[model samples]
Target: MCLLFRLYFLARRMHLSWVKSALVLWRNIMIKVGIAGITGYTGEELIRCLYQHPKVKISSLYARIEKPIHFSSIAPRFNKKIDLMCEPLNAEHMGDNCDIVFLALPHTVSMEFVPFLLKKGKRVIDLSADYRIPKDSYELWYKHEHTDSENLTQAVYGLPEINREKIKGAKLLSNPGCYPTSIILGLAPISKLISQCLIEPIIDSKSGTSGAGKKAEASFLFTEVDENLRCYKANEHQHIPEIEHFLSYEAGANIKVHFSPHLLPVRRGIMSTIYLNHESFSSIENIQKMYNDFYKNEPFVRVRPLGKFPEILDVAETNYCDIGIKFARGMLIIVSVIDNLLKGASGQAVQNMNIMCGFDEKEGLF
Candidate 1:
């Protein structure tokens, strides 16, 4: 009889411990997010960020070819922490299964799924060029037909400092390109100068190799990229049209500028040197006041004080975009840099999602 009482006491103690553990687990649970392209590097980064977040949980991980394996295979460091398998990407089920869906597909692919997700009332953040360009410009550069014309026109350019308010209300968030986001924020204040039709800002932008993604190509391999610093799209990059369109829209004029992109040997980040007519320098105080006031309330944008410029390392793993402007040779030379993968792509998409879903803008972003 004494032995039986001891056994009962042991069982009760074990039960109570499990109950307490379950309560703790429930209390600190995270907000589940669905990643639609789990095979890519950006997708892997999101997995990494969320795995560490106190309030974020990855719900659905999707990969077209790698649909039946653990996420660790693609990103080994993730190892056991993310032992989940990826499923196929289907718009029909995405909205029902996950709280939010992130599309890291190619440019035109998002158009096919984004509308359906929105219709099903799922908030979407696209990390592709599909939603970045206007319908006509997208067709011009991407060389494909965009069926969701309305969404493209209304899509908010997801530069947190500039469009956070619109992002909060948007059902579909159109995250900007790596180079464009970096370049635009740096040159925005001078946009008024250009708007007066009195200034022309020329952007000479360069990026590190990681912007090419994990895909294979003779051009991106070590042999080709090492000791190589060459310009690819001289004046005809897809992002050019996007920059022009947004600038024109913001400045209320037909904005045109010389856009050039170059490839650097390093792995990530971009620096754009822009030249604006010296007549548009405005006062340094006015310039500082404008950029500071513009991004004053914004969390991710930092406008360096006069004579202080932003460096790539300053924002390497962060969601922030830093800007520094100076006048030169009757030209306003502006330089901007970003991680190309973070602030330029996956990170911004998450930022837009936070706004659209009414979650804390900083949740899981830092």
Candidate 2:
């Protein structure tokens, strides 16, 4: 009887141990994710970020192609790290597998797949200009027909610093443009100043070749980009309207941005020099204090000390934006830098996903 009772208690203990182990395994289960347009620079960067994410498992990667292709064959760096195959963008297949879908597709392409993915109940974060603005504005700027106007109202602009609360409840997230991300964050803290004192902001932005995407073009060739610096779309860059729209909204005034974009020789990162003509320049000390106090609680924005400014290397490869302020003569100059592929695109998209899914804001980002 003593041996029988001992054996019974031992069996119970073993059963309890197995139950505990199962519970732990269930708690650590990862959320499944799908990526559309997985062949672009932003998509590749998204894979890089999600590969290290503890809470995410990439279920499928989609391209608008015919057959399945190995992921490593396209981006060799992900060879041993991710063994998944890139497949065609079939809504049924993705819907059956993933709860979240990231659209890293081009402007018009993302809109086509977004409605179907959303109908499948997959949360979407679009890294395109498609849903970033209203239908009419999109039609005007992108010069394309707007087919997804109904869902446009549902997309929250995915600039976490400005739209954190809205992003938390968003079903669709419109990731901001690279130029707009650097431009908006550099100027948001001083929106009140912009409204009250500023006349116009002349933005001179420079970005590396990778911001143009992985598409083969003569302008993006090695010889063209290596030793040359030239400005294109001087005052009519597509991002002009986007930057102006958001800044006007933030400043609570009608503001127009005089934007000029230049291509740099490097691979990634954007440095924007915003020259603001205000009624009068604030004392350098006061301006610095305002910027410091504004971003004091923010996680990713770093305001440089007085007399020191931001450089491309300061924020390259990281999901951080660095801003430096300078007052020259009667103009306030703000310099901001960010890695175009990371903070400006994929990293910001991940940040929005975290907010929407109730994960840590910095999860998979650091």
How would you encode candidate 2's per-residue C-alpha lDDT over 172-196 as one tens digit per residue?
Answer: 8899999999999998987767767
**Candidate 1 lDDT, 1-366, residue by residue in tens:** 223322333433455675444344332444567888767767776676666666667777887763467767766787877777777777677756665678888778878888888786566788888888767888989899999987777777787766666776666777888888887787676576677865656889888887877768889899998998989889899888888877776777878878889999988788787777665465667777788787778778888877677888888888888888775556556667777888888777776766654457777777
Clashing pairs in 2: none
TM-score of 2: 0.90
Backbone clash tally (model 2): 0
Give the runs in model 1 whose Cα sits over 4 Å from its true position.
1-30
What is the number of backbone collisions in each predicted candidate, taken in the order shown? 3, 0
Candidate whose TM-score is highest: 2
Angstrom error at residue 288, model 1: 2.7
Indicate the worst ten consecutive residues by lDDT in candidate 1. 1-10
